[model samples]
Target chain A: MRTLKFLLQKEFKQIFRSKSIIFSIVFAPIIQLILMPLAANYEVKNIYVAFVDHDHSSYSQKLINRVYSSIYFKAAPYSASYDDAMHLIEQNKADIIVEIPQGFEDNLVRESHDKLYLAVNAINGTKAGVGSGYLGSIIRDFNQDIQLQWKQPGHFAEAQTIDVVTNNWYNPYMSYFLFMVPGLMVSLLTGIGAFSASLNIVREKEIGTIEQINVTPIRKYHFLLGKLIPYWCLGMIVFTIGMLVSRLIYGIVPVGSIPLLYGFLAVYLLTLLGAGLLISTYSDTQQQAVSVAFFFVLIFNFISGIFTPIDSMPEWAKVLAYISPISHFAQVMRMVVLKGSGWSDVLPHLGAVFALGVVLNTWAVLNYRKTT
Target chain B: MAAITLDNIVKTYGEKDQKVLAVDQASFAVEEGEMFGLIGPDGAGKTTIFRILTTLLLPDSGTASVAGYDTAADYTQIRNCVGYMPGRFSLYQDLTVEENLKFFATIFNTTIEENYHLIKDIYVQIEPFKDRRAGKLSGGMKQKLALCCALIHKPTVLFLDEPTTGVDVVSRVEFWDMLKRLKAQGITILVSTPYMDEAVLCDRIALIQSGKILSVDTPANTVKKYPTKLYAAKASDMHQLLKDIRSYPGVASCFTFGESLHFTFRQDDAQNIAGLKATLDSGNYLDLVINEIQPNIEDYFIQISEPVHA
Candidate 1:
């Protein structure tokens, strides 16, 4: 135990001596938290609307005015033909095209029905998908307005109609950044901590200092503890700073218990740091360790429900996602912080994370060798 | 009792056909508190034997022990009793000298003050620079700090592999002097070096080459094992002189050492200096000079390492 203390002292001195690591630990999350949510947003806005309105009627003009006045779209040059509007889309001048057929205001007036065509450029898939949905909702709202205008005096008694409204329960405003900042913050903390911890051990190998340590009387567990505990503490500190940034800068204070958030973060770092140690034990050079760690961290991020909703994933991939510690931690972070979930809500996730810690940490300890 | 022992130890690396015999069926022992040296050139497997005894590597076959503990079974006990300074100066570079020393001391469950007497002579030189980072220290100081850290635990046996290989000659002398003092304090020292001159400093030395032991004895006895009378001969045209000397007959070995060629005679060759010189004279060797000289450990090392002699 005393030997481990000395080893930790040595490790911490080295970690603190490096200015680059210090900046990364203190500021990388701060930077990422402020930038990532703004960049990763999927909400489509300010879509360029190009239209070929052949109806030349008051109704067509009113529909065009409604499209321009909505919050989600902007009016671009009117194209005389569908091909010209497509050309505008190809030139990146427009995002969606509205086509009203030559009806002379006859179909909706006489038959109470009309057809409209929409062409959306889908080069950027996510942008295209969300933009089309906005256009669809805008047309639906316009149709309801026209129906209310027509239902004025003695026409029809209370027609059967169903009204639907989307409340977006967790994020009432549908703010993407508020929904994403907590998860991104979690990823950033784990990323920097795991990377620095593994690189530290492999750096010692490259410098040949490990040979001196290997010849000593120190036990393997003692050495591993000495190497991992410092980074674990560093991860928690970084996580705390990230939380402060989310709350202060983005106005994203968690509704759940902050202590519960930290409680799971402490256990999550065990799994992360343990995996990092395993990488260090297997790698002979710092470069190899970094590349391997980068690969695993990327994979963990992709499957962790940080960016995509895990419910939408395929069945097999969902199973694989649940197996990742990041998935469990990210879920708990969202649950506790965003949802104000209690102990009962996160108990299962916490148990799984602890189990991953035990398994990965035990594997790391067993793989470590004082002698080959 | 021997502080360390290796009985017919063998170590190999790689596959069967391309296998390298790093230490091949070699055996030797170092007496308690004796300053033992494994002397050879680069790639001579000096480091391999040190690694085996340090318990950092296991021999492919045969048995070895340190402090009466088996390297295989009692490795933990051996680790507790031994201190190893590997060939490279493998101390933490970013750490201050004092911190490096203190860390190693603590790991061994002791303090530097406990064994200050053993390393006081060496550590005091670098005391003023204790706050300096080890990587920024000079080669000599780096060696001293490494030595101080290795000895902080006061182990029963100390294994130093090429501790002075890259050190300056003056500092190399000081390091060996420190080793002598450590021996006096009853700490058995096993040091290996590629530098042949360092061999004579050991109380007993093993001359090894290409994964095999050539000779094991006191430095004087190893020198005595040189088979024939040797001569130091040089002339104005040394290049031409070598060709003429080799052809003039009774040369068992002729190796260049500084300005002269060390000439040794074959077992059956007559050791008549006048006759040897008369032949060289007839061969038009200019300003030829030949005289008998005592053989040193380097001469014995070369003699034994030569395939013809082995």
Candidate 2:
């Protein structure tokens, strides 16, 4: 409609006239993408290992050497007593303490087994958990090495062992960037798109311009369309920038159909912008709209399975996770980009986002009133 | 048919436990091509009546119509045929003057060229600064630009709510002159103002107070209907003069207007005036002067709305 053209023109002019909005729109996603993955890494490293060796046996020294040689840990200054090692941990200078009992070599040779103790600083739960697991695996491997050297070849054949191999299917190298870039893109795009769109109409309300428009002959749908179209275009631009950054900076390129990824992004943006407009209708000021949008966006990010696997959440939380469009979009992004999934693979996610878009847009239109 | 009509319209705000009446049993009509004014001070329901007729609000009871369209049922039709300028400057401030005008014209399904003659007089005054953003404009310039945007559509009826509330005196006079020119084109104009002096400029005026229409007539007629004689009295100590006259038995209402107190009598006769003068002269009132004066729209507005007269 002719009216829509004017509305769109006016909306774009206002959007661009405010220089601060333009600056943030073009760069916020870039900055977030560049910094988030490096900061949100789950692979824990740089653990400080402190040792308390009472026996001072050759085997104990060998085990200590093996633990420090691994890339996951660094060696701390040696402690003469368990209490001294514990003091190191308490001072935050060491992450994990390894203590060997007295007569550890004699015990292992004659009794065929020995006891070792490990104390980990549990303040940062993830670091403590992962660091202790690495140390335990290293000690187990060292025990096998010593047993093979001491035992006879005939006895070694008598003991049978089960070998387990794992093949990382999607990410062969298990690069965290590859896993995080696509998911972070979903959250970043949703944030920029929803926040700007939510503030649009409410800004007009605060400035008193909405009352002038309400008195005109402009249809409600035309007005909303005018708003949604410009923001949708901006959302696409931000999405493209994110994609280029992921591919260039993180070395991540989608394996599936590029058009299919964009197709889902288009629908996902519609759903988010619809919710944004709904917030605008309920708020009387820009500050109120921003706060309400922030509350919803924060919850969506947490439940979207970007940082944690949805499968690991409790049953109630899992149910709530699936209800959010972000979870579906993040899943589709990972599936299509990482797994090379085709149309049938992502069809369900696309359908869910579309259904949500319809409900949100309908509610927004109904809530908007020309008169009270 | 009246160009605009409100029949016993009543509107209230807030919840059931605490209701504040904004408009109550108020009714008036404006004729075609006539300039009408709803004159009142702040919180006097002038803006509420404008909102009701503009289809921006619905009266809790009774019916109102604009350009022969019912406000409740035919709201969409009414919206299309009416141009409204709210009390606040509601145009897009971030937009340039030309862009704001063009936008309003486009949304109304008409081009600025189509109604160029209607807003030409007012728009020309603001044309030189069309490239400037509206927010940066002076108060008078902003008012002129708002008028142009509201008139771009050239609706059958125009509702302007307190258009000159914050404008300077010179610009206020200029705005009234522009409105007079629009009347020659046979456009029905309904404007409201808190400035009592602006009432006499309208062809017919309705004086409202406390959600009620105190009087609806021509400016001259409303003043002529003053029930009793009014006099202006001033002294060296104007404050004492007001207190002394208010306490007098013959005084119905007395309020300070400018340098003097406008005193109206409960019983107006030659004897009452003479007695009041003698009493004031006997007191410590210095250089006291009293003279009978003709009542204006403000005087009538105060007299009718006064609780003693009610």
Candidate 3:
């Protein structure tokens, strides 16, 4: 116990003394927390829609005005021919092209039908999908507006029309930032915990200081605990900074118990830091540790549904996602903060993280042999 | 009982077709409170022996013990009783000297104040700069700090591997003097150095080469064990002199030591020396001088490690 105290003291001193470590520990996460949400936005806006209007009718001009007036789209320069609009799409100046057929107003008024052509870039699949969806909704609204003028309100009521109202339950405003902030916090904490812990141990190996420690009577657990506790504290500090940044910048206050959140975090950080130590035990150099860590971090972020929903992934990927601790933490963070969930709600996540912590730290201790 | 002992310890690195033998059947023992040295050049398996006895490495075959505890089985006990300073500077360079010392002392479950007397003589020199980071210290100062940290625990056995390899001459002399003082305190010291002169300072040294112990004895006895009478000769053209002396049929081996050529005869006879002088004289060597001088540890090391047969 006394040995562990001294080792922790030495580790903390080294951590504070290194300027790069201090930057990475205290400020890097906060900066990433503030910057990443603003940049990694899933809500695609400012979609450029070019129009090819051959009808020369007032209804066609009104449809063009409605599409441009919506916040999600911007109006590209008017094209006289469909071939001219194709040039706009090819030049990357327009994301989607809407072409109205000849006699659009006459067809809609007399025949009560009209055809419209939509050409989407489809290069950026997400942007293209969302853009085309928005355009389809806007055209449907225009068709309804013309029909209401032609028929009385009570005439459609007799035909039995169903009215659908949508309520975004957890995120009422449908703010992507609210949905992203919780997951981003998990990613930041994971990054700070795993990379720092692994690199710190590998640094000692590179410098040969571990040889001196190995020669002493220091128990393996004492040595590993000494490494773990300091980084664990640093991870907590980074986590707090992320919380404060989310509150101050995004006005996101956790509805769940803050202490409960920290309770989950404490266990989660241990699991993450244990994984870092395990990597360090297997690696002899910091370069190897960082590369291995990069591989894991990349996989964790992508599959953990930090940027994409886990349900949308294939069955094999969803199974892998459940195995990752990040997914559970992100889920708990959203549930507790957004839905005001209590301890019983987050118990499963806490239990899984604790189990992973035990497995990882045990493997780390076994691999970290004093004699070889 | 021996303070440290290795019985036919064999350690190899790598696997299968590329197995490199680091220490091949190496066996030696250090009696309690004796200053012993493993004298050899780099890659001569000196560090490997130190690592094995320090419990940082395990031997593939045979057994080793430290302070009456087996290195492989009772490592925890061996680790507690032994102090090891590896060939590389192994302390935290970012840590202050005092912090590094205190850390090592605490890990050994002792306080610096408790072992103050053990490291006092060496620690006092570095105490003034205790607040400075170890990496900022000069090479000699770093070595002194490393020694102080190793001694802070007051272990019964101390293993120092090439502690003076990069130190200055004056500091190296001082280091040996400090070792003498440590010996007075009854601490068994097992040190290794590539410098032949340092071998003379040890009470007994095992001359090692290519994972083999060539000889183990007192430096003076090892010199006495030289197979033939050795002569040091120098002339105006020293390179040519070495060639001529080696070409002589009576000459066993010739090597350039500094500016002179030290050679031995196949037959240690006055007649053989006369024949060599005649041959050099016939070659019209100018400013030629030769003398039968007392052999040192280096001369014995060179003669015994030579591949040529007498």
Which residue ranges in model 3 land beyond 4 Å of their true spot? A152-154, A157-160, B308-310
- Per-model TM-score versus the true fold: 0.95, 0.98, 0.98
Global lDDT scores for all candidate models = 0.86, 0.90, 0.90
Model 1's CAPRI class is high
For every candidate, what is the interface RMSD in angstroms?
0.9, 0.8, 0.8
What TM-score does prediction 2 earn?
A: 0.98
lDDT of 3 by residue, A1-372 (tens): 777888888888988899998898778887898899999998999999999999989999999999999999998988899899999999999999999999999998887779999999999999999999999999988998887776666688643267578999888999888899999999988887889888988988999998998898888888889989998898888888888999999999998899999999999999999999999999999999999998998898899988899999999989888888999999999998898999999998899889989999999999998887
CA RMSD of all predictions? 2.1, 1.4, 1.5
Taking the true A–B contacts (Cα pairs closer than 8 Å), what share appears in each candidate?
Answer: 0.92, 0.94, 1.00
Model 1 clashing residue pairs (backbone): none
Q: How would you encode candidate 1's per-residue C-alpha lDDT over A64-143 as one tens digit per residue? A: 88888888889878899999999998889999998999993688777667999998888988878988898898888877
Worst 10 residues of 1 chain B by lDDT: B266-275
lDDT of 2 by residue, A1-372 (tens): 898999999999998998978877788889999999999999999999999999989988888888888999998878999888889888899999988999999998887789999989999999999999999889878887777777877797744375567899999999999899999999998888788887989988888888888888888889888889999999999889999999999989999999999999999999999999999999999999999999989988998999999999989888878888999999999998899899998999889899999999999999988888
Chain A only: list TM-scores of all candidates.
0.96, 0.97, 0.97
Sort every candidate by DockQ, greatest first: 3, 2, 1
Provide per-model DockQ scores: 0.82, 0.88, 0.91
